[model samples]
Target: MYLHSVAAYLPAAIIDNAHFTRLNGLADEWIIERTGIRERRKAAPGENSNTMAIAATDAVLAQAPAFAADSIDLIVVGTYTPHDTIFTAAHAVQRHLGINEIPTVSISSACSSLLNAVEIVEGYFAMNKARRALVVVSEHNTAYNNEEDTIAGHLWGDGAAALLISKDRMSPADLLIREVVTGGAAPVSKADEAVTLKPVERGIVMPFGRDVFQQACTYMARVTQTLLDKHHIPNQELTYLIPHQANLRISLNVAKQLGLAPERAVSNIERLGNTGCAGAAIALAEVWDTIKAGNKVIVTVFGGGYSYGAMLLERN
Candidate 1:
């Protein structure tokens, strides 16, 4: 499918490294050196996953003025942090976008949710079930963070990202998702104790930092290389490696394993922190303008639930 436009919404509250420093008595440089995150955005009161998704979708539609609201026949929201348990974020987004009676899907595969959402959109197009679709990912990481935990409490932020995917080109210069690959050999479920963001007495649990870190690098590198190999696209041909913005070290290690320079990878973790499902999309939206036409960009994501995937995109 062709990507019409991309947009993102980052909350205004900036939580810098100093917040963690004061909270845990760790040096500012220590956090950066460990996670490569200097600061991240946190949602303010009243801002949640649905609101952020609406903001991002509005921005995307504004960018592609010709793509009417009625044209969208499918909507997929990739999120682990939903505003309401009874109503999916996709329901809220569809209502706000003013589209009616279309099929809306909510996916919660942790970090790979965004890529998985795109994969779903691709499947609909391949089945001739949808001509136009909107895929959005939003996460309110701070809301579930265990504030007492030093390792994960300060490592998360909140943001949303949206993308317009269609079988037909919305613009002549649109980018195409040329290839996709998903799943893995890793036992992500067994590593569940290492990483989590689920209900635990009105809050969320987190991963054991050391265990989570080790597993992340291994799976991220494996899934990324799996996608590249499927397309027979050499590492040298990849113009950009956009991995989930969970950690700087994991991204760098994936690049190294793939035989690509770290500069070829795009990252916003230092400033935006981990936006969960929204990480790759938000990071991609921020640097969309810089990617040259015809350049090959690979987006690889590994998230909680042991979920992971990758996509090969080429700017048209």
Candidate 2:
């Protein structure tokens, strides 16, 4: 079990809760009380999900340059916010990678996009479906984040992560992909408003922060514990708990309930906030250096499907 490579990308624009408050009629205290979010990033003009994911993919592939794009047998992209209406994020990524012949698919678990990608790619390897693949994820949550809701506005960022998986020298210990689960109706917005064109002018806003919290907390904990018990891995032993950037408080509380120490649980929520499907991936990317060749990591995510999913992976 070995991880061939891991990489990520962050947009240049930064948005703090205070700055968002000026646009949305929400208060910082209210946002902080509910979600432990300080700030999030926004993708600039022409900087959509594809461009972001490409950056991370380049970095990860650079780490393992021996492999070529055409050599990748499968491509799994995680995202709810895609760049085009008709195109899957994975297809766009393949186009950008200049490798369109390979199979590609997109997973939209809101914040769990990356985990789902990992799960799918892992299954491909475990079931002997395909051995070499790229798991790519990028979420520009601010694309629809209503600057109006302090809860949602301050809790998102733009970032991406990519991991090249192979059966080669990535190390057997790093190749473990243990569990996967998902439950939800749809992760998209349920608002009555019609989908509009100009995303930059009016953001994609989620008005149901409280409901999201309740659903995410319960689902993340249940799936996380189930995976841990099934794999015989203890939360106490995991080197890092990479959670989808939802809110600071929610992440903290979930860690406490799972018996993981605050330090052991890694989060970029304070600085990066939530990048939706890319949340966990970006967080993991930032901490890529700290993880050794064989660190066991627990990646959990509860996203907008009202949907949630969780998985376990060993670091390469």
Candidate 3:
């Protein structure tokens, strides 16, 4: 199926590298070198998931006026940081937009957050479960960052984006999808940081840079190749490739190893840092601004759970 339209909202607040370093006890050089991020967005203090989701959905729905807000059959909000544990971001967006009759749910997969969100939507369309759907993913937690967790702190930013998908726009042979393969070797966290922090705690945690890079590159590359081989789709024909905006080092390394030219890879990491779930979705939304009618798109993401996924789709 085709992505009917995409839209995003980066709040007015822009935090620069020097400010980040000074405020969080990090060095501009170290953060940039490791993550290829100079600066990223931080939502205003009063802003929360509900408000941002409304703004994001307004923008996304506007771009697809061909479909009405009432036509949305599914709303999947992929996120880790939420205003409250009880209020799912999807439901928040639904209520904000006055479209509460649809099915809504939240999915969290760390860096693979939005990718998993996309996969869920794909299933709905594939099974004739939904005609039109909206995927809203964002992170709104810069103030909640852990001071000691420098790695996660220095890399994350807050922003939200939405993607509108519809069946009417999809072409019969579009790389709609052949198969999806998932693999994560083991647990990165004990799921019991209670002695220190709760497993469900949404705040940042100090991540081992070396360990993250190793896990990301291995899992991303393996999953991507497995999907490619399974679909009989070659690596050379991919027109666009978007990776989870974890770090430019990890992104480029995966592309280089996968035989995709440097230009084929798309990134906003340098500018937006790691936007949690919205990383890959925002990257695709940015590219959507210039996409032609029938381009090939291959989206692969390596995320927070130490998880990774790949989707091979063609433009309608």
> Relative to the true structure, how large is the alpha-carbon lDDT of every model?
0.85, 0.72, 0.74
How do all models score by TM-score? 0.95, 0.85, 0.88
Best by lDDT: 1
For model 3, residues 1-316, the per-residue Cα lDDT tens digits are 5667777888788777888667767888888887899988888878876567778889988877776888889999987777766787887888887876677888776667776777788788878989888889878756556645665667778788888877666433223543445544447542222112233665677445667677778778778777777767688877777877878998899889889998888999888877877877788888876665466677787765567788776655
For candidate 2, write residues 153-229 as lDDT tens digits: 46667888898877555443344554566555354444122122245576655656565666666777788888888
Clash number for candidate 2: 10
Q: Please report how far candidate 2 places residue 179 from its true position, in Å.
A: 3.6
TM-score winner between 1 and 3, please give it.
Answer: 1
Model 2: worst 10 consecutive residues (lDDT sum)? 188-197
| All candidates in order of lDDT, best leading | 1, 3, 2
Query: Model 3: which residue pairs collide?
Result: 111-303, 111-304, 112-303
